[model samples]
Target chain A: MKYGIAYFPSKQIQDEVNSYRKRYDSHYALIPPHLTLKESFTADDAEIESLIPELKKIANETDPFNITINKVSSFAPISNTIYLKINPSPELQTLFDKLHSGKFSDDADHPFVPHITLAQDLVDQEYSDVFGSLKMKKYDLGDEVDRFQLLYQLDNGSWTVYETFVFGKEFV
Target chain B: MKYGIAYFPSKQIQDEVNSYRKRYDSHYALIPPHLTLKESFTADDAEIESLIPELKKIANETDPFNITINKVSSFAPISNTIYLKINPSPELQTLFDKLHSGKFSDDADHPFVPHITLAQDLVDQEYSDVFGSLKMKKYDLGDEVDRFQLLYQLDNGSWTVYETFVFGKEFV
Candidate 1:
C-alpha cells in the first residue's frame, strides 16, 4: 500500500498574517502557506498521525505561537545533504519541543530536527562533479510563514498531500 | 528488494564495455562499498533491474565531459523543487546535445538539462529553510573522474548503486 500523512502538521512558519490556513473547526490551529513545501513521503504521513494527540495536548495548555524559516544549511558542511532550517518563535518552540520529544506514536518514530529536506543522498562523480562546480547565489524577499502539510505516498510511489492546517492564526 | 547501483563491464567506453560485467567471472563490475547517503531510501530488487541497461548505455559513449555544479541552486528558482542545478559542461553539453538531438541510439534519450538532484523533493521542512539559506560558496577542488553507476530502487523506493564500471584516462 502507498504510505500517507494524515491530519494537520507544521514544518515552517510564515511571516504574513494572511498566510495562515486552518484545520479542524478551530481558527487557532492554522498553517502558513508560504512555508508549505510540495508533496510528502509515506514516512511523513505515518509520523504525523502518531503525533496528533500530543500536539493537541500541547496546544491546549500553550499560548498560540509563530515560526520562521531562517537559514539554509549543508549536511557534511560541504558534501551530501542540503536543506532549509526553521526557527519557530519561543511560544512555537514549546509546542515543537513537546511534539518532537514525543512527536510520533510509531514504534519506530523518526527524531525530529525541524528542517525541510531539499535533497538527500546525491553522490556520483559525474553527477557530483557537475553538482560541485555550482555557485549558488541567494536572494531573499519579504516572505511570510504559511501552514504545514501532512503528506502521503500513493500507489505509484508518488507523494501527495493528505491535509494542511494552520497554527497560531485563523484563515479566511 | 534493496535498491542499488552497479558499474559493469569496463569503463574504456560505453559501447565497448556493455556486455562485460554480466559475463560470468566478472564480479569486478560491482560497487563494493555501496556508496550511500545518510538519509537514503531503499528500493526493491526487481524494480531497480529495469534501469540498468539504460544507465549502462549512459555510462558508455557518454563522453568525457566537465560540468559546473557551479553553485547551490534550488528548483523553482524562487521556491524549492528539491533539486540542485548543474551547469552542463561543454563536453557534457556535447553529450546532452547528442542525446537531445537523437544523436545517441534514438531509443536511448532524454531532454538533457544535466543536473544531479540534491534531494528527491522537499516534503517535510526537516531542513528546507536551512538548506535554502545556503549559498553554494563556489570553489574548485580537482578530483579525477573515476566511474559511473547504474542505480537500483529498493522497496522503500530510494535509489542505490547496483553496478559500476571504471573509465580509463585515455578514454577520449
Candidate 2:
C-alpha cells in the first residue's frame, strides 16, 4: 500500500538541469517509452505515511546521487500497464538497484526498470500523435543530487513532497 | 491516483524457476507486485464500467502475446531496472517493447531492464547474503500465454478483473 520516495525523480530542483529541451538538436538516441512492470496498485493514507521515515533513512544513507533525466518514456500495450519513465543516470540507476533489489518480492527473476512514472490517472489513453512527433533531447538530472524528496498524494490527489533527506545524515 | 498492471517478477517466482537442471524443464516467471503508476489519475466507477467494453475492443485488436522468462540480470549503479540478459525465446520482450513503447511518455532514455523489481519498496535494507547462488539454474515463462487479464481498482482500494480477452479473440 505504501510507496517509497527513492523511486521519485521529480524531487530534483527544476532549472536548466531538469527541464526538457523543447528544440531538437542532435545527440538523441532512439528513446523509448516508460514500460510498466506490473499491474496497477493502490496505497492508503496510512500506507503512505508509514513509508516516510524509512524513505528518509535510505535517502540519507545513499549519498552523492548523480542524476540526469535523458527523456520521458511510456508504455501502452493494447491491454496492459503504462507509465512515464524518468531516465536516471547509469550510476544513479546502479545505486538504486543496490539499494532496492532485495527489499521487494521479485528479487531473483527480474531487475529494475529505471523510470519515474508520471501517473496521475488510471486510464492509458492513446497518444499516437504525441508519441509520433516528440523528439529526444538531452536533459540533465543534476550535477549532483544532494537530497531526495518523498512525494505523497494529498487529499485532493495532488502530489506534494512529504519529506526530504540530505545525504550524510544532515537532515535525517 | 490510478495505476496500471504490468508483470514484474518477485523473488518468490525467481527462486522457483532457477532450480531447473535442464533447459527442457518447463518454468514460469512469478508475477511481480503490481504497481500504482498514476499518482492522481482519474477513473470514475461509471467511467470504468463503460470503459470495459472499449477495453475489450482494444484487446480484440491487439496482437497475440507470447513470452518466455530467462536468465537473471541486474542493473548497475542501482537495480531500478533489470536487464533480461541472455534474453529468452517467445520474443516476449520485443512484443512488450513494440506494443507499449511511447504510450506512457514521449521521452525515455533507459532501455527496458527486463527483470521485475525484486522489492516494491527500496529502502535501507540488506542485500542478499546468498545472492546469485542459484544462477546456475534456468527457467521458462511457460508454454502458452493466451492473453493478459484486464483489471481496475476501486476508490476504496480494492481490485477486480474487469474483463478478459484472448490472444486473437476469446479468453483462455
CAPRI verdict (incorrect, acceptable, medium, high) for model 1: incorrect
Tens-place lDDT per residue, model 2, A70-109, is 5645545532222234554665664555444443223323
Error of 2 at B45 (Å): 4.4
> What lDDT tens digits, residue by residue, belong to model 1 across residues B113-162?
44333333344473366355544455232222334444433222223232
> How much of the real interface does each model capture, measured as fnat?
0.00, 0.00
Over A13-43, each residue of candidate 1 has an lDDT whose tens digit, in order, gives 2212112112111212211122222223235
State candidate 1's TM-score: 0.29
After superposition, the stretches of candidate 2 with alpha carbons farther than 4 Å from their true spots are A1-172, B7-42, B45-54, B62-65, B80-110, B117-125, B128-130, B134-136, B153-159, B170-172
